[model samples]
Target: MVVFDRADDTLRHLARYWGTFRQMGDPKRSPAIAALEAVLYEGRAARIHVIYDGPTTVGGRLIPGAREQFSTGILARASAGTWQRLAPKADPAPKSSPLPGRVHVVQDGDTHPAQAVLMTDAEVADWLTATAAGET
Candidate 1:
């Protein structure tokens, strides 16, 4: 959280934007990629919390195939698993813990409620606990 002109003030603009490029192009130096890169640049006081919860590919390219675009070491896979047993309407609990992989971003707050997302590796639980009670 970079403080912009916060010398005597604590108020600052919070930028929580998400990007998705589902077209074909040079992702390495693409405009959208550059914009994200700039936002996360060092000494910029801008903290971009990147969450790969959207399309798996950028510019219509697969993640494993887009080597050049993700050359900045910003990509990594996580370990996630799902429950094979069904939940009981009789209030039965499961035995194993859920995996983590899902990502939820509260961009608009209570103004727009985020859609339901099924992620693994405990990602779902984390997101659910993040913004409790309301959605914008």
Candidate 2:
């Protein structure tokens, strides 16, 4: 159970997990989600738990004496500066990358391209804004 600081990170994580699942032939098993559900259901009675600052708890014990653990990789923190840096800017449109869209979205979790990419720039911007706000 990896905890992210914002909705963007959560979306990125979902993308990465999906990419790996796809690359691995979309296994008939999903241990990660299973484990997460187990802990979530079983730990509901426990009070001692660690949490990542995000829309929900990344991983933690719902109760004491439960040995549940969640593993997460590096997740970028959400900050105004970070968002500004990652957000696509407007103006004299900067040089765009030549990489195919598939290559970019599969690279990491929260950084994956949004579904609204084909929509208007304002729509895309609004999506990012909405996601960022929801995350915090």
Candidate 3:
């Protein structure tokens, strides 16, 4: 993972807030590619956690019948298996092992209490655990 500012007082923001993830025009410089690179580099096999109401993908044009937007189409294919997975059931026990290419979308203020804005790998892991355990 790219450690932009590890210091505690630097007003840390999640990876989604990074400007590079919200850029436009160049597919080579697409935010999805950057995110996939980071995730691939981490190799944690953990689910991705997206911050709600945060910096989102900028609007882009998509040709009719195209499955994806122009800028992200290629990257989406490149990261095909790294989208998201179904939430584990909230009964019995939820799997705790790291699930590669799994993504969990959480709102900043979700109905189920969660540690919003995961800023570190540890935090993300913890949140994933809580989710697995149906604690959030």
Candidate 4:
């Protein structure tokens, strides 16, 4: 889970996970809403990320989670001053991500950093296929 430190523009780049409302699909998948709520309500660091992979201890029992490297980024922002107080003092694992403090949220699908490209349905399909093939 990556807790990016976004300031307005950067916060608009990434996507947030709104739980699905049955088969109707994502009920509140709105980046704008996330950005607005996060910065306003959660402060700037009240977000969360759920990493679903490998073996993690849930309530003391160790169980391997799902494949596909699934993760969710929360837009919940706490107080900017409290980010350090609330976040981990140090990352516990080699690949662990610290609760982010302040960083730019770059646009997704950007090639040159300055230019953005929206993926077509075919591209999305190919990406999923590649991930499933373990080629990514």
TM-score of each: 0.23, 0.25, 0.19, 0.21
lDDT of 2 by residue, 1-136 (tens): 3332464365346545755666545643344544544554544455423344443323321222222232221123334443333332311222334443321221222344322124677987888898989952
After superposing candidate 3 on the true structure, give the runs of residues whose Cα lies further than 4 Å from its correct spot.
1-67, 70-118
Specify the highest-TM-score model's number. Answer: 2
| Best candidate, lDDT | 2
Q: Mark the regions of model 4 whose C-alpha exceeds 4 Å error after superposition.
A: 1-113
After TM-score superposition, what is the CA distance of residue 113 in candidate 3 from its true location, in Å? 22
Q: Could you arrange the candidates by TM-score from highest to lowest?
A: 2, 1, 4, 3
Q: How close is candidate 2 to the true structure, as a TM-score?
A: 0.25
What digit string (tens of lDDT, one per residue) describes model 4 on residues 28-86?
A: 44544434344433342455443222222222221122211222212123333333222
lDDT for each residue of candidate 1 in 40-74, tens digit (9 for 90 to 100): 34322434433332322333333233222221221
Candidate 3 minimal-lDDT segment of 10 residues: 68-77
Off by over 4 Å in 1: 1-28, 42-44, 52-131, 134-136
The ten-residue window of minimal lDDT in model 2 covers: 101-110
> How many clashes in each candidate?
13, 7, 0, 8
Prediction 1 global C-alpha lDDT: 0.30
lDDT of 3 by residue, 9-102 (tens): 2212323345446556645343543553454334334544321221123222112222211112101111212222111221222223243333
Better of 1 and 3 by lDDT: 3
